[model samples]
Target: MLRPQGAASKKVSVPPALKSSRGVKSWKEAAAWLRARGIEDIECITPDLAGVARGKMMPSSKFTSNTSLALPSALYRHTISGDYPDETESFRYEARDSDLKLEPDLSTLSVVPWETDPTAQVICDVVDTDGESVPYAPRNVLKNIVALYAERGWKPVVAPEIEFYLVAMNDDPDYPLRPPKGRSGRSILGGQSYSIAGINEFDELIDDIYHFSEKQGLEIDTLIHEEGPAQLEINLRHGDPVALADQVFLFKRTIREAALKHGIYATFMAKPMQRQPGSAMHIHQSVIDEATGKNIFSNADGTPSQEFFHFIGGMQKYVPSSLVMLAPYVNSYRRLTPDMACPVNNAWGYDNRTTAFRVPLSDPQARRVENRLPSSDANPYLALASSLAAGYLGIKKEIEPTEPTAETANEGSIDLPRGLLEAVALLEGEPDFLEVFGKEFIGIYAGVKRGEFETFMQVISPWEREFLLLNV
Candidate 1:
């Protein structure tokens, strides 16, 4: 099967100064480091509400930290379809469509491994002209939630298990997606969960994924075949919430580039195919007290702590309202169907996969909750923010969770919103989310989703044509 290529395959040589985990702290350091690598271009980018990279690319020679790069503040207001919602009284755009400054986060600088030219990409922070952070920006939204934890003398650690599918390249949107042909020259037909041979089918692409990740300093704890045809999952090692979110953001682009090189499409759609299993980005999260440097979920005697139950209580209480962020698109709800290995309700259990919140068996130090609600299609930054925000609220409010179930939680009443519009409404109605995510962000986010849902309702589906055409 696939073997690790170790040091020999890690071809990118990072400069000693740039090798620091804290990254290049200043513009001068960034410039010197880029020059040492003979970089030609620099991509200054930031994640928008939809997690789509939006920014400008410039020659490395011209990219100084003092670069006055800015994009329209309205970028965050656009939906997945690139349509902006009609301005409402509370959420009207600035009269001039004012520009927001792009402040490069020097720590996120990394090489664009697949580029023909020696180009580097850095994630930027969206700031107002006054240099204050844009509260609604996806990255900033995540940072705000992290900052809230820090204010409480706690730090949240998150490890995300991202699932996606490899599908054959299709140019037409009307056609159904098909499993890509592997090295065996045949398309995958059945589920191949944890099959070594199944993973071997696309050994070349997996190798490239590893190499691309290595070039960018992204870590992959494990990669395995999932239950659907050509579906795969990558588990990232747990660390800081922001750092892990950044890795997940970049990893999605890396996987897509690697798959394109192999003449296939790597899709993160929640449910790309009707019959196949849907993809999920399950987040394993735990909080540690900054003073004690120990997991807050466990007590001194290694028993489950009150904070742990409160966190779960928070998830159950707030996850439904936060579904707008975790499941943003109209198609995301397709993956939450019952009996599909997906949890339909917000139930918690020990080592249970069917529950929305699963507490895996582990040591006291490693004790964490796995939030199985987020779809693979979610923006990584918002997903982490929403999950952590709920838990933070739980700890603050001291909410008590329901009894953990040992049996299937899918059979329980569906505690989640069934559609994008419903989710948007729930999120809008929740005052706590408005406070946590900010009223401006919720307004923009809900407006965008409403616009997208309206656009979706305008289209006619094949199912409608086939069933209602004659019957009606």
Candidate 2:
């Protein structure tokens, strides 16, 4: 079945990239850069939520193979339940049950600019042996949602502002785990928000991340030092919905990899510390109709107030049930308290940050609603999908949101259950969403998340022992 060495077979143009499918770099030019730099261990990585690799590591010899390889189902930080439906208990993977293949989405291939030695990484899409997408994969979920918008002659653009902290990576037997301080106490630089000099002082590391992102072909919108100390967020420009989701996935992976290479562990955990600002993945949303090239979220009357209010109403109506999607973890709800400006109530205001739903009323054409309930840890695809599902429900029903007062989201509860079970219970109580997103999906999501809660609860926490050891 092989063509002769010089068969003169016709060639097809596959753009300038993917012409040859063998190597860390999609282009021969990139491969040359690697050979010159003595780069090896061309790692093929898939990001899992629990911080594990679900793909294979390529040996230096076979780095130039022209065929794709198969891997177990990929992973991410938010699969709150069981492993991929088929993974066996043996290796925590069952290749036999796997109908999935890791197709190299060559567009994501990049050289790790931060490492001293040359290293290249590529993002792969998880596909079945029949070449169909695996439905449960996070990437596939986002891809499907994005496709829905395209099918409807509309495009949804998203930009997630990530927030997180940096803590010690080294072991200290005497000291508990905490962020490294001025030299020891886990304290961070104070009162320097938006200061150019502060950013300049750490220019080396900041610039490194920028360059790394650039090498990966991520559109760097802007990088800034957020309000909280040691809190940094890199902003990527919005693109096509599917591509934007890919970019977000890649962005998170790149940050994690680059930080680890520097021996500083970075966390995307919703709340790593009690006193600090919990990490949030606040999504700024807007939609455009492809046929007329007009933004659907914009009000044609040159006043977006009405459009903004409708979107706000959509969020307010579905947020209670949508909590399962937005805040998927126990730690996620810790950020929902009023003290953190976490939008404890489901109120919307013109250009306000205090409510769960905020209409950023800047320019009429550019106005959009900011959904603030999601944590940095929630799956962007499912969160966005749930939001879109809810928004569509709002539009269909011509929703008029109830007034937001003390009872909007129940401001009285001292300690709201952050557990997935409770969140799923609220979601189940709302039947309004079933007619749109379907009862099957809601049931599946609820079942999965609840299973995760059971699995997590089975494990004994060190905190339990610290207080109980002496007393017992």
Candidate 3:
């Protein structure tokens, strides 16, 4: 699918109509707010397919007047390793790698507390030369899914619990990561498992995280020490899916920044250490009637509504095909092993962590489902989009679900993809997935993921050398 090289193109203007409607006035107001804060640099960030922040830093003076900036449209298609598949067509080089407009979401403006300089950041969307959203952009993909709910007068509320690890700083990838020494001058031992003292060991770092989160306007609800050493989990307050996704995107960056300031490394890698539980971005979701402002998952009599069952049915029907979006990387599958309390099958249950879909204990109004399959490395935007879309499809089609499992789902027989390659194959021709996430988008995404998998397989792992090299 390689295209012949073409001449370089200059600026691509935002469509005049879109510029007027999509937060143009808000951007100017943001510019004024930055000036008032004496912000010198503005980091304009767009989320790539991998949810990594990719963009340029510009002087505040330029950002104030220009409400729009341009970047290569192909930026969204890059793999985690910064390589591209030869067959990619979403942002072809034949288009001369043309500039796509970046329109800032002024509401995402936040002070960069970690930046020593007076700097701020604003999230932006990649807009085509036609001024419409690029369909494949992660943020735009999520917005489209959210719009589907809006059309039905229903809204999806999401709360994300992201688990991560804090390890000692090391430059060598081959070296094993270990928990860093906290303020008490002792490294964390294994199996903290919600110990209050375990969290207090890193009080200084955790406190700084809260302070930074406040400055950034992140509404973090709770922080707890997880099962693994130096592993921590933070829950973001629930709200609109799009807004929650934005918070997750920014929260990851902020935590890393805070960890660096404290001379430790915080990682969201799916499986950072062997024999340790992997990090996951468990998403808790609920639907509400936009007009009545009441939950749609529960009836007035405090009983589970048909919509709730259908939503679960939708998840069971579509989640197998949607695994590529939730568990995107090779390392992601390593975390899905059975008995780790991570999901190994497409099972639904009440208050059961082993099941992929969990209906947590809550009052009638607070009722919701939690998707436990997403790794921390997964893109929050894509993860949320796939989940909300699946639930919506269930509601629309009224799909019936299997009986909820009363025990561990891993003990049951329902099978899901066991690896990234298998996950890609499952997603390859899924009509339900293709209908929700366009064909072009899935094609580009799958190609990139498969390319990454091939790249990973080429590497000789330490385990292979240690065990198989001599034994085999």
Candidate 4:
């Protein structure tokens, strides 16, 4: 029989600053916080590997108690299809369902604006019974990566530009999605590039989005109509990497819920429509010296530092191998086609959108690198973690970048893995990636994706019947 191993579990420690000002470390503090907000229920949420919020709902009293929330440890092992892989030690149904503790991150407390009742929600970190973080948990993966930066007295500041599509609600996966009709009684055909009227077309829904985001403390900066029909983008204010990730997770959920209320569907599927441009969760990243609280990538005189080039070099070297994390599914690869806004390779350039990494036009304090490879569907936590880890390694090694590109990267200028399997193969070959992300996580992630790939191959695509069957 499988057994729960509590003896090896370590206690979870909350940072002093968090405990004092932001996080609730004791039940008494949690009770006070809930009582002050008049919150009757608490929604305990954990972001899975895919950044899907999964957890339990409980009364505020229970949430404020010493009792730890227990959920199946296998929650981390599910494939994108939401099914367990075959007969693995960690994922098999035959294995006794082990429980992991879900501790609420008090800093994430916010009222659920859509809920009629006085309900609040908090994000959680999955940990072992003894309180050690689950190694395979996506949030923990990011936490470990952040710790690596902290060791070198560096802190990663990140902001995410999240893009998605608002479509008519559809239940069938086989059916194509369509843009929802706006207030003008028509759906956009094409070319809404930052048009103010386009935003007003969906102002009702956008108003709700802003309302919910404000209530939930999302710190959303801008809302714009993107390049494609019904495409939308929301930018979150930059801060700590972990905090920013939490905001992204919550923001995505908030958008979906708000869309539903307005009788529409909000999707972050990278390539939802073949004719429209793909959605991406581009991350803007910069590092600060922990002790000095200054941007490390630039000098006091506002000149680029050697650390900046190494950071860029790190991204160029590691992004190829880390594509599995940036674009996890088969559909994600479709978004990386040439000539699209999305870059096909890990090329870096200044103010050039065609490159995978872009040095945005900003002053010394605000200088940052934008990683444009990650699809909006990619897990925000994992994507940010992978990018930061690579850049940190580059700084550690003092890697140098190539000359910055002055023009758009030409067609076929950079080679990239063409498929999910190819990306997985590259990841497996990159020892540094495997070592940095952890063998346990890499194994589970690759195996689950491989299983998903096999499932996908078993199906006959529509193209087969439309052309191949009659031709053959």
lDDT-based ranking, best first? 1, 3, 4, 2
True-vs-predicted CA distance for residue 413, candidate 3, Å: 4.8
246-360: candidate 1 lDDT, tens digit per residue: 9998999999999999999999999999977899999999999999999999999999999999999999999998998999899999998996799989999999999999999
**What is the lDDT, from 0 to 100, of the residue 265 in candidate 2?**
65
List model 3 lDDT by residue over 187-306, tens digit each: 998789998999999898899899988878788899999998999999999998888899999999989999998999999999998999999999999999999999999999999999
User: What C-alpha lDDT do the candidate models reach, one value each?
Assistant: 0.92, 0.63, 0.87, 0.85
Pick by lDDT: 1 or 2, better one: 1
- Model 1 clash pairs are none
Choose the strongest candidate by lDDT: 1
TM-score of candidate 4 to 2 decimals? 0.92
* lDDT (tens digit, per residue) of candidate 4 on 419-442: 999998887778886557887888
Number of backbone collisions per candidate? 0, 4, 0, 0
Clashes of 2: 4
**lDDT, residue 313, model 4:** 95
Superposing all C-alpha atoms, what RMSD in Å does each candidate have to the true structure? 5.5, 7.9, 11.1, 9.8
Ten-residue region with minimum lDDT total, candidate 2? 85-94
Model 3 spans > 4 angstroms off: 1-25, 88-94, 412-414
Best by TM-score: 1
Those runs of model 1 whose alpha carbons end farther than 4 Å from true positions after fitting are 1-15, 18-22
